[model samples]
Target: MGLTELLFVKMTGGNPILQGLLGGIVITLMNTFGALVVLVWHKPSERFLDASLGFAAGVMLTASFTSLILPGIERGGFIPTFIGIILGALALDLADHLIPHSHAVLGYEGLAQTRLRAVWLFIIAITIHNMPEGLAVGVGFGSGDLPNALKLMLAIGIQNIPEGLAVSVSALSAGLGAHFYACFVGVRAGLVEIPLALLGAWAVHIAQPILPYAMGFAAGAMLYVISDEIVPETHRKGHERWATFGTILGVMVMLYLDVALG
Candidate 1:
């Protein structure tokens, strides 16, 4: 069989990878749908946006530890998981230095800051934030643990709603695009995950041993983003108190879901 046919079969034949991709896509779209409020109604307040960002970050942090890292250690072992986490964090750190992106409140970041347009900068920021989410979902499925994968997917999906709002608002505030168009931009940020999910699934399915490492890597990547990017963005404004409360709520919600569903 051709490689294309084999992939088609794998994806269509009840592959967890397919499930992860579909879940990611649906949630990502939901995120953009959240952004529609700006077009259909009004823009969210900065305080509200800060709180939402904190909430998403909290959700991601919980998922990384509970859903990704723990399972990774169980499947592979401490050494592999640890190595994967270090590598993952390093990879994102390098990207942060090399890629030019803007924070919602911090203006611009990264070393290669040329005269790029605000739209591209916004896109870069979104890419930095959303790429790890896709990886986590893919790695969750790749670990050969369907229940945890579903839990991770649902957790990420729920948080993506607020993330979408944050991204759309950031893009609009940066003057990247208009109403519905801005929402489209926010949605486009997550489109990179389809291929990423496929890659994660194929990798782990082919080499099952790497599943744990991959999971750890995904977790690390997400942690880096949450700590370095999302948290900073949330706290950069004066709404740190509200953001902290939002983060606590997010953690509680995810913990409840994990316990209830798991």
Candidate 2:
């Protein structure tokens, strides 16, 4: 058999590298298609959108905590994992604070003048966020723990779809070029994952000792996202109750999936 065939067989047998690639693809496609659908059906309501975004955030936060951080602690011991998590959160927090996140345009003059700039800013933030997300997925798959990795990937993918829609819908509400812009942003987020996955795979191979730290680091970054972006956005309209419910539901969903898959 040829090299391609050999690789294919390995993949079919549940290779970590293949799993990571598949996971990345799954997330990318979901974001792209989901955004497209949202663009096609445009209905903007602040309360509804906030609640939905909250739900997505909840799903992502739960997965990051349970699947990634906990596993890292279990494998790498408490002190190291805790340090890693702190460092990770600090790093992302620093980046988030330093980086000027783009907000959707409001007001007619603001919309007309800063539309493109806002779109680009949004894209950049999403890209930065997605890169780490992809890395996390890759790390999960590359760990040689197939079942958990697959479950995490599936969960993340599901969450990403709504995220895509949220971005798309938000842009549309701003009266910018929603469809094309959303597609571009969504695809960009997913593509950012590929390089991160490769890098994560290499890190795993080179520094086995740092693997848990890396996972913790990712969890920290995700936690930042949940706290800063997801929570605030979700409660934009005082739908705290719905957001809380969504978060609980998200945690339950991920837990159920983890159990069922395991």
Identify the candidate with maximal lDDT: 1
**Cα TM-score of candidate 2:** 0.85
- lDDT value for candidate 2? 0.71
Each model's lDDT comes to 0.80, 0.71
Per-residue C-alpha lDDT of model 2 across residues 168-200, encoded as one tens digit per residue: 777666565747875666666567777676666
Model 1 clash tally, residue pairs:
0
- Candidate 1 has a TM-score of 0.91
Inter-residue clash pairs, candidate 2: none
Candidate 2: 10-residue stretch with minimal lDDT: 105-114
Q: How does each model score on TM-score?
A: 0.91, 0.85
lDDT of 1 by residue, 31-74 (tens): 66766656765578999989988899889989998998888888
Question: lDDT (0-100) at residue 101 of candidate 1?
Answer: 83
